[model samples]
Target: MQDVRAGLISAFHWRSDPPVWPEHRIYYADDSAWWREPTILGELGSSLAALFSDEPPTVVMSPESRGSLLGPLVATHLGIGFAEVRKGAERASDDEVWLRRRTPPDYRDRHLEMAVRRSVLRTGDRVLFVDDWAATGAQAMACQQLAGDAGASWVGAAVIVDGLENSADRRLLMLRSLLHLRDLRRR
Candidate 1:
């Protein structure tokens, strides 16, 4: 885990040249380098799962792309199941019911619809959201709402980067990360 944190910091960068960010945001972080390293990749799942080992989730969930990658790793480490959440979904099938919600403005200020199959979350399921980065709690909140809609309890979020600016949002999401955004800068 320590090595993973060091690897993440060494790999991270804050960029402002045509950065992909909202109007009010200053710089965007580039963390793709960390994922390319074998050592970091090897330790990611177990390290992330250890963040909530005291009260491990019954199942883990992640949004479309990145989350789908990390969520399964954590679930595998903890011997739990994983569910991949869909984005901008209506209904996958006539027989299957999906719980979907429109997210609040995200870091990029884009409003997206997040969805998950209704059957994926059973009543009393302890759900934890897993992702590579979390600049805004919008997606996590949307997923949490889906969990509640299905009578599952939330167990907070686990991530590699904690870029959230709002303290209230952090508390509300119960977010934990391997490194904070400020730590990426040269010390």
Candidate 2:
């Protein structure tokens, strides 16, 4: 875990400009470096393992940014299937629901999508929502709504980091932060 953390701090130069804010700092970069850190990858995998080992067995996520990179890794770690919420248009007509995410001010005007493509949740399937980070939590709320609409049992939420100071929302059963902003503060 330390090695992964080291790689991410170096790769993203988190040491220089650690994304620490009085509130949430949802990463400053939107490039590959944000998702390429070894520590982040490992921490993501561990987060998945920790969450999936609990009651439920399935997971879903909203895609297009950090979640796009995170969803697959969590799915692979949990040995279960993963689905991405699509952005822009309605690609499917039936058997799926659509939700709009109001991202941070910086990500305003950007649309994010999350969907279940192959099979809808059956009678006893458990669903977990995973995202890269939590800032204002608009994205996470969108994901929770999607899970509810799908009729899947909502387990909880797991994140690479929880930038929000007050995280008392009920939807999150188990919340985990891989490497916090303080862990990467500028020296």
Candidate 3:
């Protein structure tokens, strides 16, 4: 875990320019470095997998884009299947049920649709949601809703970095991450 944390910290890049939102004045942590190297991703996946080892997950679900990358790696390490939540209605199948999700401003601040084949997620299956990062947790909440719709049990959520501030809702969910935003903030 220490090695993975060190690698991520060393590879992380803090942007000099502030975000459009004044509240987000701290530089954004560039995540490309972690995605570029297989070793780093594997280490992250391994660490994430370890979090749920006691109660292994039956399926790993992730949203489109970065989640598509890290989710599979974690599933591979855990020897489980992976399911993808498509980004839009266009990618959804006519036969599948589409769940619409609203993301916070930090994550494009738009509504996105996600779906999983009914056959892919079965009832009673334990699901672990994986993503590269979580700030306001809009995406994770959507994924959880997706799991709920499918009747799968949400085991928890795992991510590379967590940026959410303390909140009552967050306290109710089991969210694990290798690093927090404070860990990467420019000091």
Pick the TM-score winner.
1
Mind giving the per-residue lDDT tens digits that candidate 2 earns over 82-133? 7676545364567554544433332354445544443544434576667766
Model 2 root mean square deviation, Cα atoms: 5.4
Q: Stretches of candidate 2 above 4 Å error?
A: 14-31, 37-43, 92-123, 170-174
**All candidates' lDDT scores?**
0.86, 0.58, 0.79
Q: State the displacement of the C-alpha of residue 37, model 1, in Å, after optimal TM-score superposition.
A: 0.7
Per-residue CA lDDT of model 1 for 1-187, tens digit only, reads 7888888788777776653656754666677876798888888999888888877699998999889888888999888999789998766568988888889999889999998987777889999899988888899989989889989998999998898999999999889999887788843
Question: Between which residue pairs do clashes occur in model 1?
Answer: none
Between 1 and 2, whose lDDT is larger?
1
**Could you estimate the TM-score for every candidate?**
0.90, 0.68, 0.86
Residues 68-136, candidate 3, lDDT per residue (tens digit)? Answer: 888888999988999887766453446755555544444657665565666777788899989888877
Candidates sorted on lDDT, descending: 1, 3, 2
Which predicted model would earn the best lDDT? Answer: 1
Comparison by TM-score, 2 against 3, better one: 3
Q: Model 3 TM-score?
A: 0.86
Q: Model 1 scores what on Cα lDDT?
A: 0.86
